[model samples]
Target: MKTSNRSCPPCRSWASRRTSRTRFSEFSPQEARNERLLTALTIDQALDARDAFAKALYSSLFAWLVARINHIVYKGSKRTSAISILDIFGFEDFKENSFEQLCINYANEHLQCYFNMHIFKLEQQEYAKEKIPWQNITYTDNQPIIHLLSKKPVGILHLLDDESNFPRATDFSFLEKCHYNHALNELYSRPRLNGPEFGVRHFAGQVWYNVEGFLDKNRDTLRTDVVDLLISSSIPVRYL
Candidate 1:
């Protein structure tokens, strides 16, 4: 098992870090409030840890519940195979920062990178096996999403690097040139009253949707040809 040595909010290490009385001795309102939240979280972590420890002592309690449920559903099936379905919430947007959030984000990123590398390799292998000309494959399969997100100098992260303009000025047109151009455009084109379909792109390692306002707002230097590609609803912006 590959384990992370990083701290987690609901884990033992974080609980130990806040095990001092001086942590709550602050008198200032903001400091007091922060301390209270941290203390509450620490207590929650301790209690959760205690409960987990207690589970081993009372293992039969869980076993009995599982047995009862299985008995009710199984109906004396000769061969029973238990399959666990795990659909962990892939990436999280949290209200507060914690070790769990960091771990989840790290795992999500790691999985994404791993999957991208595999996909790239798989595509290359399949192309090789079929003896397909490398240059002819649509850009969609060739460039995985991670390549875009992790691109240097002109990538999305690069454009959003300024703290003052964190979620502001961005140009996503470069994505059209991505190896996954068709997949990228399909995602960027649609509005999202849809469900989990949006995140499917993220699993592929690319940010599907981007802000056109941000792109248009600062397009002159970042992307000169953007004005020509601008498509509006009412007014037709002729593409020359």
Candidate 2:
């Protein structure tokens, strides 16, 4: 429940020095003109404040929804079992796919790897532990693809973020960096004669993602002006 007490510095200074008059007519024409100019200068700050307010409002709504669902599912006196189903979109490959598609496919790859581990590796281990004889089953492992996407300094996402920090970085530069680093990787490829795009040999299938806007989309930066405005707002939720 703690709230930020910060107010816009210029506004605060103007307010503190203003005469204690209840009506706007008491102010001189020059004073009214100055007030209008101050208002004009703070327009951007006001817009940022509104954006922060909207984000807080939606976050509170979703939190309430989650709380309600949790209460309904787990608050009963009697023990009961319930099934929760999650519906995720299938792997997407659009003509002009960008960073979002790459993320979705990466998530799908993780899920596939998890399924393989549980259905094959773990089950085999359990059988061996129980001393039950069974033939070995073969399955495709996606560790290489996952490694390519999440490796320490050379991973695609890492490279993208790194390049994004540079002032003059572009999507083409990001693509070139990916190509140079992952050129030796079998799971990564660049299409010959095709415009800025790369392909990942996922466990399920191969997906070529367009590199346009990759750096910009993955940047995920919030303007400092917005942060300052949110911190200076009168709304309590803006602090949170």
Candidate 3:
């Protein structure tokens, strides 16, 4: 199996050079604009009305080219074995407050909801083979943190929808509470390597999580930026 990590421009610009086929994610609109502005400057063009119009046209063309490549990749890929890692911005402690934090938290909570579904689907498929009473099983029976993150209408998805009654920060804190409430030790309660855990082991082949780092308990916050980036980057680390 091969693995690759994708990064934002700021991070990629600073990354160590490595010998691998480079893959660039499609640039966002702002980045396209910046690229065009730089290109115009290199051509010794003054920033004027005509220059602005030309820059806009060239930026749109550049964006279209990137998007075209992205679409071709999306449509042509036939790799049956593929895993996507997501690495968004990380979370912050109360001390580190900003719109960046809010966006990161908001995104993570929604991800938790997806994580919850993944766990449930795995469990359900396992129980089907075992003839276990699946419906009677508590969704929160094993993954408490995921359950909490996915709790009811108050879950991350609900909170992210701006039309919802809850404020963004409030919804974010609610999900963060679930994530930070427990110490990392909780993973031990569930069977990880053998016995009943093996039932779902086969189905778990495609998707697995690798988590690292720890939160500052005394500070009651997380160093979410790196972890969040990993999660958003197509590298799954939801449990941590």
Candidate 4:
């Protein structure tokens, strides 16, 4: 079920969930306060992050409910007749995309890679083993694209996470670092000589992502003081 926006949700509801879940440290302000203590963010920025955090919680909760429902509906099925549902967001491209768009497109890249492996690579390999006479079908291998966005150490996500925690980091700095690291990668490119924009060559198409607010989105957190107040307030329910 979709959450209602008519009433103010228990601000501490998010905090309660964070407290119960050892992971997702960003959810609770008490535990998450020290993370950005040194980082200087404006009041407007803090409010924006709060809104983003709430949305993230709703997204996660909905995803969890879907998983539970699927388990209940598909339980005890015959292995031979069982089916897998690959439900995920479609490839997205807009005139001005941000961190969310990048994440969606990255997931698409992984899905496309999975398709290529099963449809082209694995099938062709099976034919070769059987000595079957068939034409080889080539497909775009998205491993390079995956590596561009998710490789260890210097990957875009690693850089983003690192920048999110660092007090001195900014969106401009994040994009500049990405350009410096991925300048030579074919799947990644600089769209302009200046500004916080980068281009990624996805299976569907190339998308230009603006790095504005990228760092803050990556570091999803609520204001510590506001959280303290919410934790002390009474609420109808708290889902952990």
- What residue runs in model 1 are displaced by over 4 Å at the alpha carbon? 1-88, 134-240
lDDT of each: 0.38, 0.69, 0.34, 0.72
Candidate 4 per-residue lDDT, tens place, 27-111, comes to 3233365563334446666567557657755765555555556666765663232236668778899888999999998888888
For model 3, how big is the CA root-mean-square deviation? 18.2
- Compose the digit string of candidate 1's lDDT tens values, residues 131-172: 988863322342444443445654333433432243432234
> What is candidate 2's lDDT per residue for 1-240, written digit by digit as tens?
543443211122112112321112122122464473212224443444445445555665455555546657886675433336575658887777788889998898888888899999999999999999999999999988999998889899999889999989999998898999998999998888857999998876788888876775665444444444445444443423
lDDT of candidate model 3 versus the reference = 0.34
Which candidate's TM-score is highest?
4
Sorting all predicted structures by lDDT, with the top scorer first, yields: 4, 2, 1, 3
Worst 10 residues of 1 by lDDT: 7-16
Checking candidate 1 for backbone clashes, the offending pairs are: 139-179, 140-179, 140-180, 140-181, 143-179, 145-205, 146-205
Query: What are the per-residue Cα lDDT tens digits for candidate 3 across 1-240?
Result: 543332121112122212210211111112464573212222222222223333443554455545545655666655332334467644343432333343345455455556656777677888898998758444533343334324465432333342223333343343343344322433312225422110111111111211110111111222222223334442222212
Q: Compared to the true structure, candidate 4 yields what TM-score? A: 0.71
C-alpha root-mean-square deviation, each candidate: 21.4, 10.5, 18.2, 7.8
TM-score of 1: 0.28
Query: TM-scores, in order shown?
Result: 0.28, 0.65, 0.27, 0.71
